[model samples]
Target: MSDLAILKRRHALLGEKAPLFYEEPVHIVRGEGVWLYGPNDEKYLDGYNNVPTVGHCHPHVVDALAKQAGKLNVHTRYLNEEILNYGERLTATMDDSLSRAFFVCTGSEANELAIRIARCATGGMGIIGSDATYHGNTSTVMELATNRKMGGPKRKKSNVRSVPFPQMYRAPKGMSEGALAQAYAAEIQAAIDDFEKRGIKFAGMLVCPIFANEGLPDVPLGYFELMQQIVHGAGGVIIFDEVQSGFGRTGSMWGYENTGIVPDIVTMGKPMGNGHPLAGVVCRPELGDAFHAESTYFNTFGGNPVSCAVGNAVLDVLEQEQLVEQAAEVSAYLRSGLDLLKNDFDLIGDIRNNGMFFAVELVKNRKKKKASKKKPLRIVNMMKEKGVLISSIGADRNILKIRPPLPFTTDHADIVLEKLTECLIEVEG
Candidate 1:
């Protein structure tokens, strides 16, 4: 079908507001390692998808899925050795405290279950999230997505509160990094105090360790440490939403590994099953026990045999290929290339990256750092036309988000940098 025809049908069925990339959406028909193919077989370098963590249709992952499905695919209610094996292997990569696992089908479901566990274990109702971040789309989790900065109408939920995520690029003038960290951490304490004032017991603070959605900002030094002190002091747990930053995306097994503090719970998904619907929450044993004891929770297909097989295959690829180390090396090379671009392009304000994930903020004036909201979309569309796929993030929608599959190499980085430079020139003109 034609792009216009598909678009028309998409709008009719999925509603006009369903999101699509670029001004002219490409009709993708298939995918392979680090690339997507149009219906006509024109290939575009994939640089914005994290779901296919290992790579698109990796033979190993595909084989595992096929083999498992051919043998058996059933819900989690029955005895499933795949779940037990995968769970043991997965948690062994984390801090010893986070030893228990709860299976779920999506990042949203993982986060929802994490929150439920926090509330149950802590005996509190209040939840905290970043002012300009997203966790998921479920009703309760949607509360975290409703903060004013996201441009959505605020949901009036008394039990939820949001604090400014710390970022050095936009810190108040003349404030030291230490002060900035303190100021940001103070916001969490303020929220906790507010919950107490309003007679709401504090549950926990949940946020992305690297603040990926907040433009992948360079968090002020010592922020996580102060945040740990404040949250734990208030008798609240810490939940790190590693949905995007986990599975070696951060050059580490987990995003929290880069941070100084350890979280009480971690929710992960996206890349877990390498495009399969597998996601989960890992937490302290006490919290897991309390949650299960008080509230019954079971997802019918969360930890199915097929999903676990896919998850295992993804892990196998990560280990056998050493993609985590590659993410570090390639991302460093790519960031250096972007640094060179920043030196030439006055529109480039700041560039931040976490391993394979990158955010390049565009500005109308470098001195003022005024976000150039319109230019990013233009650049993204232009890059799309150039046979490269990229996207934008941040509250202003002015930061380019380039996160590709794990197999992306320096060659792929060169293509991204070359296309980006051309787009910047044309957009600047």
Candidate 2:
């Protein structure tokens, strides 16, 4: 059967919930480092994906998986040294107060459990999330993911609130950088006030330190600190959804580190196991105590031996390879290159990046007017046809998201730039 037919068959068997990106999809046969090989043996430079936090199929992670799978892969019901060690090492990377780890199989699960813990601990019903922020796909988290169209109605009206995202490029009039930060904080405070008037205290504020999927917009300096103060003052916990920005993706061990604030809870995934199915929530010990006292939570395969081993190996490889430092160094280089591109391209409006996470916002006529999403989508498809892989996002899909793995090098960036330039030229023409 053809690949399309096979995919259709599989989707049918899996039910109609499966989503397809495009009608016709290139069949990726293999991946190594930052390159993906198509069925026709076409080599595509990966420039817009980072789920493989390390390069795709890093040998260290592969070897660890093989070794652990051969030895043991038991569930969490059984005590295992690998689980204990992995948990300790992972939590050790965070603040001392965040000493407890609750493992799960995906970012969605981690966020779902984190919300439960927060609500239980705070004894409050309301949760606040940023506008255009995506947390996860689980039912509970879906409510918090204001970016998804389906989330609006699924969200419980009384229990959820959304504050405007702090996109500096699109800040309100007269909003200076300092004032923008203050206004964003004030928005959160106002949300708390609204909830208080309704007799609904807040459980927590869920945020991404550097908002991903919302155009890779970085929170203004002092934003999180001020938000934390507001949440704390209102007796609400602060939960950092680091599912995309964690594990050194933001030039730090954790994204919250860059914000200079320790969140009450943090949900991490995607890069934690370097593509392996592992995610976790680390919380202040006191919160953990309260959560555990209220309810027993368990995931059958969350911290299984194999998953723990893979998680540990990812950490080992990150440190041994100094990939975090590499992200920091390469990010600077990429940003400089993007800055140059912005200077040259009139269509490029704004460039925002953190560590390896970079975004290029395209504009229509260079007067800072919003660019049509259709143009960026066309550019992305053109780039893919040119043997380069990148993706477009933003509320309008006008921002090109360029988040390659940590192992992506300067040379890789140059290749991506060349291909991107070709696509841009074609689109411009």
Off by over 4 Å in 1: 147-157
RMSD of each: 1.3, 1.8
In candidate 1, position 274 carries an lDDT of 90
Candidate 1 per-residue C-alpha lDDT over 227-301 given as tens digits, one digit per residue, 9 for 90 to 100:
999989998999999999999999999999999999999999999999999999999999999998899998999
Q: Could you tell me how far off, in angstroms, the CA of residue 216 lies in candidate 1 after the best superposition? A: 0.5
Q: Show the colliding residue pairs in model 1.
A: none
Clashes of each: 0, 0
Each candidate's TM vs. the true structure?
0.98, 0.95
What lDDT is reached at residue 381 by model 2? 79
lDDT for each residue of candidate 2 in 292-363, tens digit (9 for 90 to 100): 999999899899999999999999988999999999999999889889877777878888998989888898
Tell me the TM-score of model 1.
0.98
Location of the lowest summed lDDT over 10 successive residues in candidate 2: 148-157
Deviation (Å) of 221 in candidate 2: 2.2
